[model samples]
Target: MGLLMFYEYLSRIEALIEKHDDIGLHNYLDAMHAADIAEVLENLESDEQRQVFGLLTDEKATEVLEELNSDDFSELIKALTYEKKVTLLDLMSQDDIVDKLNELPESRQKEIIAFLDYEDAADVKDLLLYEEDTAGGIMTKDYVSIQKDYSIYYAIETLRAIAPDAETIYYIYVVDDAERLVGVISLRELIIASPNRSVESVMNENVITVNINDDQEEVARIVSKYDLLAVPVVDNGNVMHGIITIDDVLDVIEEEATEDIYKFAGTSDEEVYEHDDTLFDRVKNSVRSRLPWLVITIFGGLLSAKVLASYQTTISANASLAMFMPLLAGMGGNVGTQSSTITVRNIATHMIEGADILRTLIHEISVGMLVGMFCAIIVGTAALFMHAEYHIAIIVGISMCANMVTAATIGTIVPLIFKRIGVDPAVASAPFITTTIDLTGLTIYFTLATMMIANL
Candidate 1:
């Protein structure tokens, strides 16, 4: 639905551009939603983007500019004139303006800051003081809050006055005499209650709130856990600063998912899927994030080599052992990776809690056991035919069972241990699990072969 709407709008935008110069184009673009315009702008070439942007009203241009990804925002800022940039900055929300400013170089950011209105500039400065991945960084200072003493009638009128500027009015926070957050009331309740009822009487005291210092991922987890529309943010004194809305939480979720995916693939979180970034810049980002992981994996491989070399005599005496080595190691790695992936994802999403970690481990172990038993039967039968030795069959079956069980156990435990140590479980689990399984599988294969086959 959104794509179709955007395509229809883009066709209209294109037709308008053909018929009219910048001024007329600007008028048409100003009438569209910021999100729709952003979609269209992103689809256009650089030259086309400049042309379309030239046609937009200052406010509309800023809205669409702020809606773009960081890479696109940086590009758009470079294309615009100093005067136009100042005008766009003036029109954007303080939070959005700060975000854009943060993406620019120091000199560019200083120049833009100089052009901002003193009050707006201060808000941006304060927001920029926090780390980018905190509740303080993403929140807006434009949320609706009312004194607890106001009657529902007065509150309604106040909401009407501020509704245009506020990002969301779903939950109106109630602050006390010292500006400390005391309670909250939903817009639905406010509308349904008696007009004369005081906000203090109607509001619920048990408000869910997050501190400014809380991690953005933690903020997202809280919002998702409580199924909240918006969560208030407060300082140590309980003074209301801003509220993190569902929209912001959604953005956090996307960012966290992107970060985890990049980490898994040995890439950086900053690598975005936009054309605005240069090839060299992309490669720089990729290499910086990936090289360390590759180096670590190299060491892991060396460890595996040392383990295999330690059993050189076993492999020399029975060259057939070398044939099944790759098979056993490969299967174990696959199973370990599968378990770790599921466990890490479940833990990150909060679907699996700390208390349930043991249960999840047991469940995964059961799955691994079933899988191992099935594979052991198949491989054991195959070994009986190929080697015509009952001892080789027993050795293969026992090795398979042991390796699978070990893989499953390592896969389940590694992520949990990473979580316990305050490391991102997803980032550390996969490689570690695969390495452990490789070492354990090779040891089991050789040890079982030595004991069982030598007796036969």
Candidate 2:
């Protein structure tokens, strides 16, 4: 919805709430989509949010519950009566229910599970065993699978019986008598084939699968690469456990993207999830995440200062050399940050590693040199116009070009090194990159200035 239009609806909801118009509020909510309702709930006060949520029909309530952020979901569910919670959980998807239950205390998880049906409870418990970042954690048990010996007619009949409850019925898996995944057949293929054909004959055996222990990101990569609607999760023995749908992959992508964004900004995504917390806790989280980077930057600042002090004699010989120091440092930091962003993005997309790493580094540095040379010409001319001295112009231009080259080299290499060391490449963030570049840029500038002192 448009911002202004949403605010209008919000205003009307607020007005309705004040007047205690339950019927009107329920009618208004029915007209809005679940996602939109979730947004409205976010803007409302806690008590008001509860009141508004209470008005939603069971189906709408379950949909809205899935749409809410984790914090909101937990808080709202905790506020509801036990019976109400069970009703909503019953309507929600199995994966979504597990996600909500995972956010609650263990006692609460057990309490909710006890209220759920036997199979649903068992599925939730089984899914909870995997690490949250793994493929099994996100996979849903709600998928269609049939015995390999089953005929196409049996498969079609089974799909009809289970299709409504299954998260995805497009790709039907075929398993052996031991329940080991053997092959897969698409819905279209099954429909057109002869009714008497066995699943083993029609199903493709070259099934692309992900290990249950595989990282969620790898699962997303496979799903994207193969253009799969869903991928089967299996144990070492190839016994299929569950299926990861595209919707789950989408959630993982969004989460990883958000986490990377926070990391690049020299912080953790914890702060975002804690946005509703008290002011002090927020500040503490901010310092905890950012202080390490700031410490590194402070150390870099000291080293740069030491470099400047060592070149005091050269600096005093020509104050104009010091004048262009900011230009050199600024250009270097800018180029380095640009290079870092590109490398990090490529790494996130699984494009740069091994031989690709060296190629990316060389390409970025070469591009940086060409860019520096172009900027050097402009700056050198500007220096001549500003200082009207060949020595000053020559020193500044050379330093600028050299600084840019070093910046790109450091920027590209540092992230790759971090990745190799099993650290998140995004932790080689802009602040760290720019700080290191500035320190090196100063050394390059001052060294050139020292060399030019005789002429000055």
Candidate number of the best lDDT: 2
Model 1 poorest 10 in a row by lDDT: 265-274
Q: Write the per-residue lDDT of candidate 1 for residues 1-456, one digit (tens) a residue.
A: 277887898888888777866676776777778888888888787777788877776767777887886657767877888887777877777767667767777787776688777877787788888878898888788789999999999999999998777768899999988989999999999999899999999999999899998999999999998999888888898998887878778988998998887766656676663566689988887788777877777887898889778888877877777767777888899888888888889888777776798899999899989999999999889888887467667777778878898898888888888888988887754555677788889888888787776676
lDDT of 2 at 290: 88
Q: Residue 406 in candidate 2 has what lDDT?
A: 95
Highest TM-score against the true fold, candidate: 2
Question: Which portions of model 1 show Cα errors greater than 4 Å?
Answer: 1-33, 39-47, 57-59, 71-91, 270-274, 351-354
What is residue 145's positional error in candidate 1, in angstroms?
Answer: 0.9
User: Candidate 2's residue-wise lDDT over 390-415, tens digit each?
Assistant: 97798888888888999999988898
RMSD of each: 3.2, 1.8
**Candidate 2 colliding pairs, count:** 0
